[model samples]
Target: MQHLSILPILLPLFSGALLLLPPFSKTLKRQRLLAVLSMLLQVVIGFALVASVQFDGVTQYILGDWRPPYGIVLVADPMSSVMVCVTNFLAFGALCYATGYHDRTGGYFYPLFMFQVMGINGAFLTGDVFNLFVFFEVLLIASYALLIHGGGKHKTQATTHYVILNLAGSSVFLFGLGILYGTLGTLNIADMAQKVGDLEGSVAILAKIGALLLMVVFGMKAALLPLHFWLPKTYSSASAPVAAIFAVMTKVGIYSILRIHGVVFGDDAGELANVAQSWLWPLALLTVVIGTIGALASPTLKLLTANLVVLSAGTLMVCAALGNEAATSAALYYMVHSTLVAGGMFLLADMIARQRGKAEDRFVVAKTMDNPIFLGILFAIAAIAVIGMPPFSGFLGKVMILQAAHSTAEQLWVWPILLLSSLGALIALSRAGTTLFWRHSSSKQASDEKQTIHLGEWLGIVLLLGASPLLALFGGPISELTIDAAVFLHDPSLSVDALLTSPLADGGF
Candidate 1:
């Protein structure tokens, strides 16, 4: 169990490193097989970790006999466990999709993909804030390589902008961490939370400033308003499988916000408690408004899905800004709902582009696909789920969020923006669906040049789209898990205490 906690990060790191070595590195098929088997093993480990955390309460593993507030530790609770599970699940599905669709592979694609997952897993599992920064860079660097994988003009352009912007965000992140460590003399997340609670006056003010700066860094990563310009072009230009995996990347920032604010700056956080609310709430609403508008205005299917990605982030951030257990819980549920739906939508867009020839997902009157009905059904599922239609997880998630917001005075503002945002998403999706399926679709449509859909691509999209209804079906248990995760975050003493006091582990938890 102790090893399991570290394996999520180390497994991918070592696997990626070994794949780049001779013999294995020369064979793309061998590399792909290794990546798949490794990720599947990770999924199993992630599930067992989640189970262990639930049974044993919070479990901490001190690295190399070092303890918390002094040495490195990896703590697993409901939140990190579920997050790791979701990330590995996405990586597996996307890898399957990549293997089937990509005409060329090899290169650093397989290795970088593994490192990307490792970075995401590390960010989720680490108990130290500084390690979070390390993981963020790991993921971002791999993403930079992945972004330009195919080597095109547009991709190169997107990669340059993305690299520059994230470099700036990284600098801000380090500066904020420096301020925090200088103020509290520690980088361990658990210790920072406790020390943050002990501050007063000038020290509290410094800590708040540091927290706010860190929030700004996370905001850029999450694609929040004013910082979201990089997402549309970057996501739209990336390869389908890459874009699909990137779906969870934004949610990474959301998870950080929930974990940091809910634990480090909770109600007992003195003056810093809710300090971000005054600015965070309005920014979230504006992001929703802008993202909706961008979706409505997009002329291409990939671009539209890209905009919806931002919309999902902003919508979830509304709950984060609310800063309550119920709200955070609902936000987590919505996060899961949105990630799958958006990933499906991105892959679907790629398929449409592949089949549509010159029109290439332009939302204009293009040729109908070979399996129009099959493709159309997939698109409908995505649109319906994303737009929050009934009997699906999206609707349930949205309703839960609205109800949670009702408990706050900001409900007046939260309700309208969310409702209007939903309406905006609906209108945009309806127009796109009509343009793609209704007006352009033809009975006489046929294409000798149409590319046949592969089994692997179908399975990938199906797994993602299929999850929405299943989430709706299992809504009770999933929601309960989110609520439990939120409760642990709200009183993080349960998460932090074990880190400080747990005995050294030889092998297992």
Candidate 2:
């Protein structure tokens, strides 16, 4: 079971490497088969890891038989394991969608996709702060390639800005790591958590600054206010599958904040306990406000979905800022709901674009689609789920967040902003849906061009969209898991003790 901790990272790494080799490299069919099989295996392995962690508690895999506070380790607790499971599930759906035409537009699409999954899994599983930085770079490098896979002037321009900003963020991340390591003397996260409360005077000041710098990097990754201007264009410009998979990338930042700030600098840390809460609360609220406005002003369905992603990020940040187990649990639930729904929305928008001829996904009247009823049904389901309507997991997720906020001082602020944002999202999405499906131009000539809808694409959309109802139906057990995970995260001793004292494993937990 301990060995399973590393498979999530390794499966994708080796699969991507193999996909770049001869037979797979020359044949798209072979590449698709390999990628799908790898992802299917990943989903199985991910669930196994989650189940093992749930049954056995925290499990750590020591590399080279080395011990913690010295050697590299991969730790699997409830939260990280669940995240891996969710990521693999989403990756599978996105890969299924991409096998249609998105993969054909560029070389190494399958390989790059696998590499991106490897990086994300590594980030979730790694127990060292420095290793987190390494995984961040891995994911970012792969994403840069994936974003421009189709090759267009607009994509090039978006990628250019995305690269510049992330490069700057990466530099800041390294500086923060240097300062933290210099002051703390160890980059192992469990070790850092143990030692953080012992610092004094100048060293403590430096550590605080370093911690906040890391927070800045995380906020940028989460697309918090003032740093979120690049997201809508970047996401809207990408191909459907790329955009769909990119939905989970922001949660990576949210996870980091929970792992580092929530655990390392938690209530137990002297002077640094909950250091990020003050700034996070206000900035998170502002992010919701601005993101809601952006969504309302969006002229295209894809752009609107991108803005909604920003809004969801802000909502998740609010939960993080609350600094309680309830909030954390709610954040986890909402995170999953938002990622799946937003991804479905992106794919649905792309389908609409394909059917609309020159009108694309823009909110404008165009010739009626070849299959309006079918596409309309998908769009409505996606819109209802994304807008937090009842019977869908999104509504339940938002309610959990609101309930978590109740009795807190920030409730007054959080309730208004979050509810208002939902209202805005509803208005914008309703307008887009009506414009695309209701108002039609009979005067325009019927389109001679028709894009083929692949079976894989339909299954992909169903799998992702279908998650909403499943999550809702099983909300009880899943919520219990998240609640336990949140409690586990708050108490760092469980992780530290497990990492430090667990006996060497020969494929047994």
Candidate 3:
């Protein structure tokens, strides 16, 4: 039962590796069949892991039987479990979509796709700080490869920018990790939390510095305010399915901020307690304000969605900065909602662009889409969810976040910005939708001339868009679970205890 935590990581890792073998890699059809079955299993295992945590509080698996403060641990509290489950669902949907959309026999798409999922799962499950850095590299490499799977000038250029920026972030990450290890004398996250408050004077000050550096590293990844320039290009140039899957990547930065800030350098960490703490709420507001403006000003559908992703990241960071039980719960809910909606929009934008021919998804009067009814329906769903309208998880998440932040010192600023951003998003999306769908050139191509969106493509978009309501339908239980997760996080000692106490069933490999 404890070992369920490792299955998410292992399933994708082994599956991707096996698929890379000649016997499997030679046949794309077989690979696709295996990938779908593998992902379905992953989704089940992920939910099981989430269930285990809610029932058991914390579930950790130690590698090589080395135990906490020494061994690598994979811990699943409700938060990580939720992320794992959502990631698996998103990957499966996106993978299924990609199958019919892309050339099944072309390049290393399936293998790299699985590896990308593996990296994401590893990031969510690893309990050691250094290993977190390792997983980031793993995911980044896979993304770099996948970004250019079928090359284009824009894609190649965007991939280069994305790679360079991330590599620099990786370097910053390593430098901070070194200082962190030197200050706390440990790399295990729970151990660091256990040890940080015990340090005094110089070591404690250095620890704070390390925490700040790590914050900057994660900040870049999350596209927080001043650090967000790389996003528009990266998303605008990527293929539809690739951009959709990348939606969860930003959440990694949010999760890292929450984990590292809420646990290791938490309120109990002596002088390090408030490290990078002051910036969360204010930066989130600024990010949203800037991002909303950017989205409004964006000239293309791809760019608009990219800007919206930045806006969503800022929204989640508000909770990270609040660092309270309610705020954390709200943040988790918002993460899931934003990821699904944003992913669906990316794919929809891609399909729209393909249908628009040379005009692409530019916010201009262009030819009508091949399937305007299907596209309009899905696009409207995504847009409504993005703007945080009623009857969707976005509305629920915002309500929870707003309610959670009402008493915080930052509320005076937070409330208005969120409200204003939503309004702005509504206006921007309305205009874009009208321009793309309602107003069109008279020289319309025949129905036969439009691009045929494959079943896999529609299924992928539908699954992602459909999840918003599913979240709303299941809101009660999920919220309660997030509150539990938040309580566990608020008291990092629970995580530490769980890591220390988690029994090793396999002994040593």
What tens digits encode model 3's per-residue C-alpha lDDT throughout 411-466?
88778889999998999999889989998887875553747778888888899999
Over 4 Å off, model 2: 444-447, 502-509
Predicted structure with the largest TM-score when compared to the true one? 2
Top lDDT hit = 2
Q: Given candidate 2, what's the lDDT at residue 249? A: 92
Which residue pairs show collisions in model 3?
none
Q: Alpha-carbon error at 40 in model 2, in Å?
A: 1.2
TM-score of each: 0.96, 0.98, 0.96
For candidate 1, what is the lDDT?
0.85
Q: Which residue runs does candidate 1 get wrong by more than 4 Å? A: 103-106, 441-448, 502-509
User: Candidate 1 versus the native: TM-score?
Assistant: 0.96
**Candidate order by decreasing lDDT:** 2, 3, 1
Over 115-144, each residue of candidate 1 has an lDDT whose tens digit, in order, gives 999999999988888989999999999999
lDDT of each: 0.85, 0.90, 0.86
